[model samples]
Target: MLELRPNCECCDRDLPPQSAEARICTYECTFCASCAETVFAGVCPNCGGNFVPRPIRPENKLLKDPASTKRQLRSAPCGARTAA
Candidate 1:
C-alpha cells in the first residue's frame, strides 16, 4: 500500500490523507500538486518516475489500514526532473 505520506517531500506542505493536491510516484514518493507541476515538472525527484494523483483511502477503511503519519521531507535541492 502507498504510504500516503503526510506532507510534500519537496516543499514540506501538509497533505492530509484525503488531499486532492497530493501526487505520488510509483515508488510512492509524495509531493504537492504545485511542486509536482511547477518544481518537478510532474516528475519524482527520488524515484525518477512520473507522478499521478494520489488515491484517497476511504475514511472508514483508514480506521483499519491507517494513512501514514510519517513525513519524508527532502533536505537537499530537488534536482533535475527525471525521465518519465
Candidate 2:
C-alpha cells in the first residue's frame, strides 16, 4: 500500500489524503506540483525521474492502515539523487 505521505518532501507543504497537488516521481519521490514543474522542472531531485501526481489512497482504508501518526515530513529518499 502507498504510504500516503503527509507533506511535500521538499517544501514541507501539506499533502493531506485528498490533495490533488502532490506530485511524485517513479520512485515515489514526493513534491508539490508547483515545485515539481517550476522549481525542479519536473525532475525529482532525489530520483532523477519525471514527476507525476501521486495517487490518493481511498479514505475507507483509514480504518485499516491509518494515516501517519505524526506530522513529520521527509525529502525524497536515496537511490537516484540528482543536482537541483
Candidate 3:
C-alpha cells in the first residue's frame, strides 16, 4: 500500500491524502508537483527514479488504511544534491 506521505520532502509543503498535487516515486518518496516537476524535473533525487502522481485512497477505505501522518523531509533543500 502507498504510504501517502503527509508532506513534500523537498519543500515541506503539506500534501493531504487527497491532494492532486502530490507526486511519488517507486520508492514512495513524496513531493509536491511543483518540486517534482520544476525543481527535480520529474526525477526523484533520493532514488534516481521518475515520479508519478500519487493515488488517493477512497474515503471509506481510508478509515481502515489511513494515510500516513509521518512527514518526511530531505536533509537538504530541493536539488541541493546530485543524483547518484
Model 3 agreement with the true structure over 1-84: per-residue lDDT tens digits: 898999989878899998999999999999999889989999999999999999998899999999999988898667643321
Indicate which candidate wins on lDDT. Answer: 3
CA lDDT of each prediction against the hidden true structure: 0.85, 0.71, 0.88
Better of 1 and 2 by lDDT: 1
Those runs of model 3 whose alpha carbons end farther than 4 Å from true positions after fitting are 79-84
Per-prediction RMSD in angstroms? 5.2, 5.9, 4.7
lDDT of 1 at 37: 94
Task: Estimate the overall C-alpha local distance difference test score of candidate 1.
Answer: 0.85
* Candidate 3 steric clashes: 0
Candidate with more favorable, higher lDDT: 2 or 3: 3
Candidate 2 backbone collisions, by pair: none
Q: Give the poorly placed runs of model 1, Cα more than 4 Å off.
A: 79-84
Q: Estimate each model's TM-score.
A: 0.88, 0.75, 0.90
